[model samples]
Target: MTLSPAVDAWAEEEPGAATDRSGWPGGIPSRVVRPRAVIEVQQLLAEAYRTRTPVIPRGAGSGLAAGAVGVEGAILLDLSALDRILELDADEQLARVEPGVITADLDAAASAHGLMYAPDPGSVGISTIGGNIATNAGGLRGAKYGVTRDHVLALDVVLADGSLVRVGRDTIKGVTGYDLVSLFTGSEGTLGVVVGATVRLIPRPARTATAAAYFADIATAARAVTAITRSGVRPAVLEILDGRTLAAIDDLEGTALRERGDALVVIQTDGYGAEEELEVLTSAIAALATDVQTATDAAASDALLFARRRALPALEALGRVLIEDIAVPRKRLAEAVDGISDIAQEEGVDIFVFGHAGDGNLHPIIVTERGAADDPVPDAAASAAERIFALALELGGTITAEHGVGRLKKEWALRELGPEVHALQWRLKEAFDSRGILNPGSSL
Candidate 1:
């Protein structure tokens, strides 16, 4: 097939730094394409589509699930080179950016104008806006500001056939067409390639307050989470760490958190209305927690939040970990925690649990000793994860809350959706990519 010299210039044989943090099972791509412009991306896709070569859109390589893991002889479309903030209109409270723009970089730019981009995944420092949109990511602030879908105003997508289509609106409200923006937000690159997005931003809050609430046990802490949201206290950040997680923090070099309590709940209230919000949160939490320690300053709040920030890394220090992101109804969080602990005990697996408790989203890490390179995930570890997935579904919860259903959880996701619904999703996929060239074998 004939191609533009510019598109051919984008090819590289080696994956380079793009594969550094990915869980891409060593499936080497035939070529990695790093297009710098939308037209180049279109040309590359057009050739790949005509050639019937599989293509996987990739950004940052920070994804935990193997969503970016490619099939043999595939073309990995590396978007990082396309990073550019095309426009930022403070008056419109809107920003137009290419797919490769880092999430935190955009937020920092927005902050200069007293505006904020809200869908912050834990890996916001390195995760890309395109990846966030693909996953519909959520974070600590998600309890109030919502996820990526909430902030995305519109998207410019490249379909499998190399046609570019713009969907959604810049205005906050519009019923002009079918909600294609929502349809592609969490599609995981299957339906189309998201090349650009117009995102909504919110005004920055003026004042804020924080508190670290201590609970006798996880169930009590979990119960307070249910109460805080229902009590009309909209906390900007509400995180929880169980006893095991606290122990990990204690073991972390230069940290002293275990002495505080077996279960810890960190809360932050922001905005001009923060004073009243802080009072409501503290009062509601004080009723349940053994003691509620309010932060006297931002430093204190940071100290309180430090343990949560280090939870996953601290667990990773022990060994390899498969983090699970399952969320149940807020009322059932205590039960979910208990059920997860029970699974760990039965499976002989070491599991550390913690997450954004305000929304009942939990990240239960299944810890195991590190194995040799190229070794598949251990059978015992895989079985334990399956059990956890089963428990979440039994409790009327989703298998994934913020994380997309990548290669790791695709089978379980199919089980969760059942046959008819799963088939319907495929029909949509077929309508978009009839040859199944886009990120095949990922979330349906």
Candidate 2:
């Protein structure tokens, strides 16, 4: 298992080498390899290919799904050491960066030029660009600017056999060939490892407005979301939090949010007409909301957004959490939330619902009593999660919105994709990696 000199190796005993943020323990790998350059990655992969050894690609291990989990007798390829911003072209409105560059770092770098990298997942501060691309990660601004796939202009990928090839063009518009750039963007490392990427950036919004609307329940808040969506205001961030989530946050942060209402909608509008958009957003939801509060300054705006961002952490503070991501059609968003409440009651578990309401992506987090760090998910929680997935599919939505299927949602993903499309996907996987050495059995 000798790797290139440019690659750093760690024995299986090294802490945190075999798992990811999913809190699932992937079997200990034979070793962990951190490659500093593309050639190093290529060399390591070539050897792994020749030996038919499994290789799992990982960024910062911030993935919620088990996408980056290591396998027994496999090689864990860590790309964090390759962190670098290769180029930032303001005139072209694009930036070329190594896969390991943190998502927030790129946005910060772009901000200096009055531009921003739009795909800001919740883990932006810790997650890498490569990982975001792998999952097609979405975030608060997803309703407006879209996700990782929308921002990615091109990619430098190391194929399963250790060949380096580029996909996509640097230009904004291209239809010369198959959309391989997209194919690889959300492939979850089953196809290839992203070594470097050229991503598109957008100008930073000149103005911004924020507002918080409280409602009696999440379903009601969801109805308000539908109204805002239909109003044609196009808010930059539209998020919702349920009663349980509000209570949890209040308990953890000593905030009186739960006292105000059982559910909340936090909205932020940006760009030159941000103030005008905010007015439309508030007006659309005013009648339905128990109370509506708008921010008058930047500090007040961040204060409103902070609670929405803290939803996950507050839930985590209560106990072990199984965070699930599902998206339904915007019109059915309220139905989806109501169905989830029903599922929670039937399963006798506490499920806190929240997410990017503007785009119909919901995070229904199932919380259980705290136990061992590696404890298996309880049967009730698992059953509740399965039903949630079924509901998402029943409502013409997906089992996963931003989180890649990885190892967690494979069964449901199969049900969602159906046999014919699943077979076609397998054929595509076979075409890319015949030996099945690249993150095998982790995604697709």
The best candidate by TM-score is 2
Clashing pairs in 1: none
lDDT of 2 by residue, 62-111 (tens): 99889989788989899998899999999999999999999999999999
Clashes of each: 0, 0
* Candidate 1 residue spans exceeding 4 A from truth: 1-26
Candidate 2 wrongly placed segments (more than 4 Å): 1-6
Q: Give the 10-residue window scoring lowest on summed lDDT in candidate 2.
A: 3-12
Our model 2 lands, by Cα RMSD against the true structure, at 1.2
lDDT of 1 by residue, 317-435 (tens): 88877888999888999999999889889889898899988777999898888875456777877888898899899999999998889787888889999999999999999999999
